[model samples]
Target: MTEQQETPPTGVSKALQKDIPQATVARLATYLRVLAVLADEAVAIVSSEELAVAAGVGSAKLRKDLSFLGPNGVRGVGYDVIKLRDRIEDVLGLSEGHRVVLVGAGHLGRALVGYGGFRRRGFAMVGLFDNDPAVIGTSVTGLIVRDVAELTDAVAALEPTIAVITVPDAAAQGVCDLLVAAGLQCVLSFSALALEAPATVEVRRVDLAVEMQLLSFERARNAESAAEEAMSAAAGALLPRVSMTTSKGAVVQP
Candidate 1:
């Protein structure tokens, strides 16, 4: 068989493509957030220790993640906050703006549309949709909430590659199906439902209740760990240990 022709990646595909680990990819966004704070505070040259603490990671792991984008750090002097931030943004494809549409103009959807971070982080909210007639034609965050019935047309007109589904669990799957059919390759769903999509599409579920439960679990674990440590310390102190030798290596008991 003759060698098959290699198709070139489209601009958007190129932006989305990266060889980094999913873990690193997740951390990169967090790092970018930390970096943005540093930049805003006019702080230059952040040490690995400082950056890692801010990003909730180890300094060594942070360095490794940065290395995936090639060498962007200066030895000894740490990383230049602004330059590193730019590099990270480019790697995460935040350097280019992404057109995003919100489906399910309920409370969750409305809140997300009003969130300025979406625009600040390079995601442009192009449209909002809902199936409820009461919400349709209503203005939200300066944009009118269109009926979900218009999703197909909106997708054709707006060409959104990303969609956010904040519909209820009962409606999430259908909304997701519509989104995928309408050619949205990436989706973020706030519903509690487990969404199924084609292999070509990516679906991320963000259940607020689940997240809150996870937070509660973590807090409980932390509290238990702290209590265990305190108990151990108290037990150790009460053991009545005999004092030994000092710097002179002489044996003594107190």
Candidate 2:
């Protein structure tokens, strides 16, 4: 059994949800993960500084983010790990498991189906689908890949919370439209192409190429900054230093 800990009631006010910055929202997920590890370790209470360090953030920023969820931390004791974790889960809509269906069942789709992280993160993969006749009926990670033609019918039967599209770029928009028509409210697409959907639907793209490009840009910028600093240091070393008198009247070269 884990260590006994005081757990506060878990709930988030609608006002708390309102006007939360996206950056804070993103960091909440990170905090939740850190809290999960702490909870699993049976850690009862976690100080703000400790939790912040574990979550790769500063204590001030972490406290500010938690402020949106209301004051739960004790003055001297810090936060109740389980309670804080539960509250963050509620805020991010992770308290309830999200059922997911992946379309395409290609190489990437198969790889994703095999990944265990999604299931661990409360996302249930209910179905795997593809348009290819040969791909259909094949079992990938225990899920039998169904024909894309059955997508609408499957959506009605399974009632997935999110649809993951891993189809090719050319077919991405069409697949997105089909998912929208089938009444999926949330979509996670890995296609490089941009998809069009109604404002009511939430579409998130995971373009690996674009992410790589961004990393490349940062790498180049860091290299340039390093070079500029090196040049500045070299130039400063070349410049002759002026003699200065100290408060004690001793001469010093600065």
Candidate 3:
């Protein structure tokens, strides 16, 4: 009998792998965005520590995260900025363009239509829709705003796979229903209202107020950190100019 050789486990080789976590993949996308910014700044190479800081993660965590995708980095030289960026773009399906339609054409809708981030990230804004006749036929971000009544027709013509709903909470469900009927597979909803859709369609909600609150929390944390640093500086200045050992065995130098 001939001896059989076992195949080595390749990390994240297949799309349907059960081991890789969705959260990790999403973080990888974020890391890719940060890497793009670094590349734009002409950063040639980045250590795991530097990349983690750019991605708002710890070095160890970033290393473990990238390890799941395979050996994508060098030991002493760290990761090549452009190569890692391309690899991540390929992994996140951002290499190909995704067509998107904006519904509502209100403040948030217009902002999203004009958002540079979407364009930079490979999402193409195909069209905009609004119920108001005045806003209809107007151009926002080089795309003509069309009537909501022609939503189905516009979607069919554009073949938009993703729809962004920025309509009023009262009208969100209706807009979502229309989007579903128009054959949209994914929706990035910015409305406050929760919507019910078919099992096949995916909806991601982005609440402005919730985001504002999170930002406020971050500001508070930063303020607290600043206050602590100031107090430490003041305490250091007040102490005698000498090296001292505290009762707790911590060495303090002034």
Candidate 4:
């Protein structure tokens, strides 16, 4: 959604993509998110360079990534923000709203239900389910929690294309089994454990703890790096900050 800054100097032929690489496909999702933000901010045309910067990718790589969408952006004038966004939507199958159902009303489940991101991204949370009697009739984020035993029936009736699993590790497989049989083709699993689904079904696992641990590792690396830099600086400070070179320079410290 960002405005175009500068035009490309050379004329270019229309780019083509027979099949997008998985890496590029992954990056396109990120691009879509950035485009949405830019569109919300009222950005119109965005040069490849600008979009790349915003998306944390190289300009050439971003341009190549977008080429998979086919002739969406003009080489010189840049891309029309809305047009590019729509193209990505078409590619991602987000042009149509996808119905979703939540399984498990645990803490993580409750959070996913309340999250507005799915709705914002053309995914609608149509139903909520949990097994516990205490939570069965309770409402989280305006949807009444139905008993998990009703999942198969609920899926048949609700016809949700996406099923979200936030149950504990012990229950994830059971929940997954129900979802596959209930005719849901896609699942978003938040449990720490991996759930095995049929080859026909697609399951996207999101382990929050693993992600946090990765961040922790990164932080530790950065701290170690900083400590190394500080030690180097402290050692350097013990020596001369500047040095002078005579006519026949001995590289003498001034």
Best by TM-score: 2
Best prediction by lDDT: 2
How well does each candidate superpose onto the true structure, as a TM-score?
0.80, 0.85, 0.77, 0.78
Candidate 2 — worst ten consecutive residues by lDDT sum? 245-254
lDDT of 4 by residue, 1-254 (tens): 23342432111111223366777777888888888988999999999989988777778888878866655677688888887887787777677779999988988888888888888888899999888999999889889999888888888889998899988889899999989988889999988787898899999998767767766766676677567668879887544424422222211111
Model 3, position 12: C-alpha lDDT score: 38
lDDT of 3: 0.79
For residues 131-211, could you state the per-residue lDDT of candidate 3 as single tens digits? Answer: 998999999979898999999998889998789998888999999999999899899998888899999999998876886
**What is the C-alpha local distance difference test score of candidate 1?**
0.79
Candidate 1: TM-score?
0.80
Task: Report the C-alpha lDDT of model 1 over 1-254, residue by residue, as the tens digit.
Answer: 13332433233224334667787878888888888888889999899989988776778888887776665677888999988887777777677779999998877888899999888788999999998888899999899999898899899999987899988789989988998888899999887778999999989887677757756766676677567668879887544334421222211111
Rank candidates, TM-score, best first: 2, 1, 4, 3
Q: How do the residues 1-254 of candidate 2 rate in per-residue lDDT, one tens digit apiece? A: 13233343453434467768888888888888889889989999999999988877778888888988876799879999998988888888888989999999988998888888788778889999999988899899889999999999999999999999999999999999999999999999998877999999999998787767766766676677567668879887544334422222211111
Clashing residue pair totals per candidate (backbone < 3 A): 0, 0, 0, 0
Among residues 3 or more apart in sequence or in different chains, the pairs in candidate 1 whose N, CA or C atoms overlap within 3 Å are none
Score each candidate by Cα lDDT: 0.79, 0.83, 0.79, 0.78
Please tell me which model should have the higher lDDT, number 1 or number 4: 1
Model 3 stretches astray by more than 4 angstroms:
1-23, 215-254
RMSD of 3: 8.4
| Number of colliding residue pairs in model 2 | 0
Instruction: Please list the residue runs of candidate 1 whose C-alpha ends up more than 4 Å from where it truly belongs after superposition.
Output: 1-19, 41-44, 237-254
